[model samples]
Target: MPDIKDPLFQPYSLGSLQLPNRVVMPPMTRSRASQPGDVPNALMAEYYAQRASAGLIVSEGTWISPLGKGYAWTPGIHTPAQVAGWRQVTEAVHAACGRIYAQLWHVGRLSHTSLLGGQAPVSSSAIQAEGVNVFVAENDGTPGFVQASRPRALDKAEIRAIVDEYRQASRNAVAAGFDGVELHAANGYLANQFIDSNANDRTDEYGGSLENRLRFLDEVARALVEGVGDASRVGIRLAPLTTLNGCADADPETTYLAAAKLLGEIGVGYLHIAEADWDDAPLMPVAFKERLRTAFPGTLIYAGHYTAERAREAVARGWADLIGFGRPFVANPDLPERLRIGAPLNEHDRATLFGGEARGLIDYPALEAAEA
Candidate 1:
């Protein structure tokens, strides 16, 4: 059993919601949505319900529109059928006494033409994401990773349209019964394309100055706040130092501190930071983390390759209000309990991590079942 002083098992108040623990199951793309319409389904609902013990569960990245899609078999929140499909997921989670948020995603230049009906992917600039690949179905409908196609820059009008799409998606998420919505501004997606320096080279209002670079994120976050009818129901994810999918800023500290201040000004509920988790990745300076805690007044969550000791240390030190465990939550449905009791965990099957049946999605036994 965990000590009474263990911060990881303590209850937390996230806005109006009371979370039972500080373990966050972050949004991870499983690519397991039903095909044809990219709809959520019963299998996903079961998967989430099994892991509802987390303090919060941010659903797998669901595209806001067809154009927002970057990979095959991932879910979307655009159409009526998609919304209905997600209603089942939310109902299931709620019945299990879990709080869940939908992650709205748009994968800008990190997409292939095949996934977009031969239309070019859109980004802040017309640059090909060299040495990066997006998952897509080939001409024969066989899914595999392919080189990202060259993208065209979005016009100001088109940028506004995408912002509107994000707004509507947030509304759809709420209608589908989610507790709130999270904007996937991290992981080299559409919003990150605008924020990162090397990926954006336009000489327009949406580029050049730091304020201009952060404009898209601001608009989108405001739209989400409006869509949810409250600022406390919206969160934004940001990856300042990660260069995933060829998105990297020349000065991440300055860029992200400014971004954090902007989010604070917008009155969003939380700021979730995705730390670079790759081996030998540049460490995010502790000073920057302190600055971020100052910059954003609401809840702060940090997710990466965090061990139980590291997570407790971060939370106990006030660096993170909550710590997200990604792969740990994959194979351990009772992750919070396992961490509390120091129980052994089931190893995740890497082969079935994406676009498969229930083998890896829901087969992991809970602690009781494992013991039995």
Candidate 2:
């Protein structure tokens, strides 16, 4: 019998949505979208439906426009074809009684010219990201990682245009039957390029002072809220400490606390924090977590290298309202049940993690099938 007493199994209400458990399948870029159009397809739908047991599922980071794309073979939420493609995925998840949120993404300077039709990527400033490589298709159509291209700073008008794209993406997500939309503000993406001090050196209103640096985020969040027509259907992800893709803030706590407070005032439904998960990464101080909890009066989710025991402890300590399992969900479709009954998890195949066919995408067996 399952342990009903597990905290992860407790039902929680997130705005108007009631989650069956506290386990979340955080967004993971599978890079398996159909080629030539970057559209979600039947294989992707089956992959998500197989893992519909998660209390909440945040779909892979989806570009809001062709310019927002950084990686090869990822899905987009910008066009009619993309929207229709996602509708199939959402319908499949809903059929299995799962709730999903589309993660709106823009990679900013973390993109290569090949992916941008030879156009330089855009960022808060004309700075190129170092020590990070983005996936792209080479001349022979072979996909590989390449250094990010130099980016041109966006002028005021272009900035507004991208913001408008995000707004439309949010509406598209709803039209496609997503339960809500999550702004991909974390992972050193476009929003992070504007928020992080090291990345945004522009002296314009979108850069410099902390509030100034956050202006872009604020505008984008408001746009998302307005586009969704409900603040309760919008969430923002932030990575205060992570320097992923060469973006870092002078003081993550202060920057993120202010970001959280701003989102709170805007009344976004929740805040998802992506902790530094890399080996030897700095641990996010407990004090900062507590302060964030106080600043944002909404559902809080933390993801990164969390075990079931740690997840329960975080909930018990009031540090997190929910937990997101990343790679675990990749290999174990029934991750929640496995964690609930202390079942061993299947190891994910790292080589097959990126663009691939159904082998590593949806071939993982459920507990019942494994036992049988």
Candidate 3:
């Protein structure tokens, strides 16, 4: 008897927040927003609201400052209008009896001059990522992504300002009616830049030695916890296994484990990590992620090409407490219901992922919606 009860359907706790089920609506980058960089559209609200059956819903990456907008059209939390806009989003999710967390982001150096409000993108060092940013190319006939520009490194004063932005963003998320705030420390963003030695070549406190490099993220975690007070009201996302855009280090596993242990020590909610880049390549070995379960010593969320069967297995074996679904969630709004009944899922469309009208964003047919 393997707890015969579906591990995926069980209720769990991350400190003070009580989740209704273990299935999580993980953060997916849609890059859709209203003009002026601070407003979320009605479609995004409906899209997230319809999928509220999951235990938790983490929002798309939201910039905490103007420079944070490494890509165009992504939502932000730096203005009054943005807060009010998010208020509507939170109200809708709560009306559906769902809990939501906003992911605070700073896309350091992942932008071009056009995307940064006519300014250059900032980075940990004067290095550029050898990859493309997937945002809606404005002025083009149809929506699509493009390559980013080389970026300049941030000075110490600017670095301090960025930390303040995260602190303020955490406060703004609480005021906007979210249950918690998620620091976006993954996916080659600002915090991840500091974590990756290749991306971070500064001799300042935010670079060099592991402790020095990790200081910025630690400060962010502490500040976010201070903003919300309760550990349950705080969570973080980290993409530890990514070697994308030619970003590499001497030893990523050691670097990530140190970062994970630091977050666990900070005591601000759960640690959500990108378990692997995809099905073909998982960043550390399965054994390494399992070891991180103990290293974190808090609720651990694992995402990256995980199937329902695999998720259940991970939960049963204690490799992860919650499972964050990316692609499956993209094509299935009523994902929990579908999984419970072993229903067939709608395949996600690659064309409509980034910036589209409503084809793939909100048109994912739930079982009941389709039946009706």
Top lDDT: which candidate number? 2
Per-model TM values vs. the true structure? 0.98, 0.98, 0.95
Instruction: Give the alpha carbon lDDT tens digit for every residue of 152-213 in model 3.
Output: 88888988888888889999999999999999888788788888888888887888999988
**Which 10-residue span in candidate 2 carries the lowest summed lDDT?**
1-10
- lDDT scores in order: 0.92, 0.94, 0.83
| Residue lDDT tens for model 2, 146-217 | 999999999999999999999999999999999999999999899999999999999889989999999999
- Order by lDDT, highest first: 2, 1, 3
CA shift at 160, candidate 2, in angstroms? 0.6
Look at candidate 1 and give me any clashing residue pairs. Answer: none
Q: For candidate 1, lDDT tens digit of each residue in 49-102? A: 998989999999999998899998999999999999999999999999999999
Error of 2 at 61 (Å): 0.4
Off by over 4 Å in 1: 1-3
Off by over 4 Å in 2: 1-4
